[model samples]
Structures are given as structure tokens and as C-alpha cells.
Target: MDISIHRPESLSGSLREAWHRAADESPGYANPFLSPEFAAGIGGFRGGARVAVLSEGTEAVGFFPYERTSLGVGRAVGLGLSDCQALVHRPGVTWDAQELLRACGLSVFEFDHLVEEQKPFDRYVTGTFASPVVDLKTGEGGYAQWLRGAYPGLARTTLKKERRLGRDLGEVRFVFDERDPAMLRTLMQWKSAQYRRTSRMDRFARPWIVNVVEHLFRVREEHFTGVLSVVYAGDRPVAAHFGPRSRTVFAAWFTAYDPELSYYSPGLIMHLRMAEAAGREGVRVMDLGRGEKEYKDWLKTRELRVGEGFVSRSHPVATAHRLWRRPVRGLRNTVLAHPRLREPADRLLKTVGALRTSGGTGSGRERSGRADPARTGSDRAGPHAR
Candidate 1:
């Protein structure tokens, strides 16, 4: 096996074609996050982004995308934002972790959402967590019928809310793949407000992140496409979602709604609508990503295991990086794994959020998006912890 590193944009068209072929042939590598388009999207914004190609004779058989920092530290591309990460490769293709690291000029490679099937890096894994997903099936029925059949317990209540929402506001309508750019901006604003109100890091506050999302919104490809789904009440937008999808998989990414209309459960409505529409569009699965939440439990048909850890090559930089990051991840996992610890942590964060928002200059709804009394536990998006 021979390894060579190149900037994502520098990859030849034929090399990219081979990468897509590998993804199509491997069931485990089909997530949109693993697509070449996504890697290039990140590379366009992040200067450190690079793709390591593994070739056998004249044919490229594998691709590993990552971001490299000074002192030989490396991480999965778009680590905090990407829900899935892997060295996408064809079946029967394998490489030594140490050799790969040497070839890429890395002392350590860190990843949180590493796919379980990545056997070459299996020994580097420290912990594994569940990533919930919906197995979608479409036929004669539409969203309403599909919802009823898939989640009998949730269907009645959710459908009832949709009806009330329509009657009170206006005729509630859903667009599975909304092409409007304005709605995309609205989603970012709402997500920013949600983050601030939850006392979490506002991803949209970063210019690069905003640029990347905007760039991806324009990307339309068979292997990866940015989908923006929205729910409207008459002429008013009630909720919206923006996520990436491969040919067969849709990854649930950023989702937000009008805080004033939280009582109507717009967030839940948006997800159900997205799922049904996606299934109709030939999507076989909707990945909710690696996080635990009440909504995920209600919607997921199964869970995929993702590992987190560091792959290193006996260097001081590798050892130091592990020592610094491992404890932080460990502390966070402990809090999330147990309700006793998680509940207090949540309350503390909310208190801080309330204080922070109250002092800021914004509309009450925008300032307190996550603090709305009408928004129950079920309405919250899973925390995208860094």
C-alpha cells in the first residue's frame, strides 16, 4: 500500500470518482459526511484540511480526510460539526495506523464519531456511544400515514398538535426540500438564538462555519446534497431544518423553530415531515447523530455505535495531546451518561443562559428561545457538545 497526502481541492477528477465508487460499495461509508464533496467543502474554508489517498499500483482504494495543526497534531475534518467520520475505503483494503500517521506527517489523530467498522484504528478506541437513526419506509401513504404506522404512541399527540397549529395559525404546510436561501438564514439565526439561550457555544457566531453552511447549501450532487426543510403556517415560517444527505442516508443537523410557537411543537413537526419526505425521495435512513435526547428515543428505530479516542505514534506531541483532551471528554461523558449528574448540570447551564440572555439586547423571544415555558423537554434539539 502507498499513501500520499494532497489538499482536498487538488484531487484529480478521476481520484474523486474513485472515492465516490468506494463509498457506494461500502455500506459503512455512505454517510454524507464521508463524501468527497463534504471534505472539499470543509477544505474550502479550513486551511488545514487535507485528504490522504491510499493507492495500490495505479488505483486509489482509500481516502482519509483530516485537519492538521502545527506540531503534527491532527483531527477529523469538521470534527465538532460532522456527525460521522471515517477513512472511507473499499472492502478488503487495510493499512497500518502507525504507517498511515507517518505518511500524513501526524503524531496523533483524534476523532469522536469514528465509525465502528474502522478496524485498523480499533485498538485506539477508548469508548463507544450510540447514534440513533430512523429506518424510513415509504409506500402508498404520505407523512401522516407513515408517522402513524412508525410511531403509534407519538403519532396521535403530534398529529393533534399539527391540526391545532393549522387551525389557530393557518393551513400548516411542509416543504421537504425548500430552495429558498432566506429560510436558510432564518435557520441560522434561530439556531444562534437557541445556542445562546441554552448557554452553549453559538456555532453561527463563527464566520467560517456560516460560510461553510452557505457553501454546502449550493452543493447538489448524487453523493451529497444539502437539504433545507421548512414548515410553514400560512405565509409564516414556523420551523426549519438544514442537513446533508447522501443517496441513501440523511443526517439530521441543525434544527430550530419560532420560540413563540413552541407550544405547537414545530420542531417535532419539522422532523416528522422531513423523515417522511426523505423516505419518499429514496432515503433509507435518517441519522439523528451521536447524542441522547427524549425526541431521539421516540423517533429512532435503531442505533449505530461510534467510538471516540486518539490514534498515536509514540511521540511527545501525541502523548501530550491525549493527556489534554481525554480528561475533558471523559468528564463530559460522565455527566451525560448519568441522570443524577446531568440534571444539575442542565439546570446550572439554564440559569447561566437566563442571566446571559437577560443582559443582552434582543427581542424577548430571541433572547429566551430555549427558555420558553411552552417548550418542553421533548422540544429541545440534542446538544451538539464539542
Candidate 2:
């Protein structure tokens, strides 16, 4: 019933230990994005980063990480970058959302990927969407053996393509945790090109996000570790993925492949390899994130629900923030929910992308790895790997 707010880096070691214990005790809270380390990483680049600790007597029972604007409007920490958000708490611990807001000195708090078990914030939820996940298990045999048994058809096709890729290139090898910093740069470059080609927001263009990824890459901890997996062919990187992992969960965040090798379905190969390696590394779930995509359907064992909404008090700032942000989110959700509308929107984006590419200063040759029409409706650059 007692709440205290502090800068993420200022949290005592004991408080972080309690936070980790809370994550271990709860199923959904196990995601790396909810970890104190992740919050601190974001806090390093984002000045608004903070954590709200809820306590009963001497024991800290809950942790809520968020970013607040000067206007007192707040949002989940790393909102656009984090795939999971929650008020991680010990079992049976509960607090009022409004009280927590007041304690944090916020007029409103908004989130897009709120955990489903947040009963206190249930009334504030406006919509719930399916977030796909792959439950991984290191079978009696290895990854290949398990894949064949679990998804015979998919394994057959994917494995065959991987073989072809190897034969044409050199050897196809997968690195579960690549340490080279250059590989990280390669991923960002490919992802940037992919964004430009698809006409989506280029997240890598922002220096802070770039810095955040680099900072996280060097972090090796029990609760949050940045994992960069690469699929290489004949010493050439064909596909790569960068995401964060906790003890039990690995979130699928940024993934990109050599566009020239799109015909071989390198992105699919990357996901399958990452899942296998994650299972061996003690990860129980590979969160594919919230989105509708064909690759997700083929790989997911089940789906978890995530909410998007605003929790607010009767303040003009809260009302104004809702009015401005809600409609944009509503339109995006509507487009993503219906394929009939989504297809056209995608086409228009590609068209705009083409125009931009033609007029841009970068040489056409530099963008060679992009412009794959086959990836238009599917998971080309990792946004919606449909």
C-alpha cells in the first residue's frame, strides 16, 4: 500500500533483487523488457526513465518502470522499443492504479503492450491484441530433431532451403550469441534499409535508440541479456536478429536479413535457429511480439493477449493526450486487424517508399539489398513478418 518513485539507476541492489524475484515468481513478468536492467539501460539515454516501488512495511513487493514527460504525462519505459510492459509484483500484491499515478506524480500513464494479468488496470484497457509466442523445449534430441517431429512440413521445407543456401553459397552456420560489434552495425544497416524500402519509421535513425541497443549488447546479466543471432552462409552473414532475453523468456525484437537472399527465406531460418538456441540456453518462451504475421502463425505454440490503453485522472493534460494519441492507434489497429485494408495500405507504403528511394541522395546501388517485392505482404524487414 506504500509507493515510492526513484530514478532507475538509484534503486538499491536489494530492490533490484526483489524485482528479479518478482519476475521469477510470475509467468508473464519473466520478459526481459520488464527487468530493472532494461529500465536502467533506457534510462541512460532517456532522461524520463523511472521506477515506482510499492512496499508493505519493510518489504518491496512491486516495480513499475515508466517514462514521464515534463507535462506529467507518462508512458511505459521504451514504449516503441519494448515488446512487453507491466507492474511486476509479488504474488497476491495489489495496488490502486490511480493511487500509483498520484504517487508517481503523473496525470496519465499510457501503454501499448500491457500484460493481461494487470487486473488493477483492467478497466482502463481499451483493446486487447494477440501476441504470439513460441514455447521452446530442448527435446531428447537436438533442435533439428525436435523441429522435424513438431512441425514436419515446415521443418522439411526450411531445412531444404537452408541446404540449398549452403550449397550455393558456402556453409550455413548459426551463431546463437555473436559478440562481434560489427555484426550489430550490419543488423542496424539492413534494418534501416528495410525501413526505408517499406516506408516505415526508421528507428535506427535515432541516435538514442542506437545507443540503447549498443549499451544493451554489452550487458550480460541473469535478468536481461542482449542476444544477437546470425545466420551465416560461407562466411557471409545472411540473416541476423537482435533482442533481449531474461532467464526464462527471449523477446523477438529487431530482425533483418540480406535482401539479396530473400528468396531463401533467411528470416524464417533465423527465427527457427534462435528458438532452438534459446531453449538450450534456459529460455522457456520466445516472445514473437504483438503483430499478425504468417511466420508467427507457423512458429507460435500459442498466443498471449496484450492491452493498449491510457490510465488517467481527471486532468486536462490527460484528456488532451488521449485525444491526440488514441485515434492514431485506433486507425493502426484497424488496419492491422483486417487484411483487406492492410494489403492496400502496404502497397501504398511501398509506392511511397519507391518514390522516396528514387529521389533520395543515397545512390541506388547502396540500397541494393532492399526492394524485394516478394516481401511486401510478408515479414520482409521484421515489422510484421506476415
The global Cα lDDT (0 to 1) of model 1 is 0.85
RMSD of each: 3.0, 3.5
lDDT of 1 by residue, 233-294 (tens): 99999988889999999998888888778777787788888888999999999998887776
**Steric overlap count per candidate:** 0, 3
Q: 1-386, model 2: which lDDT tens digit per residue?
A: 88999899788999999999998898879999999999999999999999999999999999999999999999999988888899999999989999999999999999988999999999999999888889998876876797797677679877888899999999999999999999999999888887787688888899999999999999999888999999999999998889999989998888877877887878777888888889988899999888777678888999999998999999999999999999988887888788899889877886777778875533222132323222432233222332
TM-score of each: 0.94, 0.93
Query: Model 1: how far is 191 from its true place, Å?
Result: 0.5
The ten-residue window of minimal lDDT in model 1 covers: 370-379
List residue ranges in candidate 1 displaced over 4 A. Answer: 359-383
Model 2 pairs in collision: 294-386, 379-385, 379-386
Error of 1 at 217 (Å): 0.4
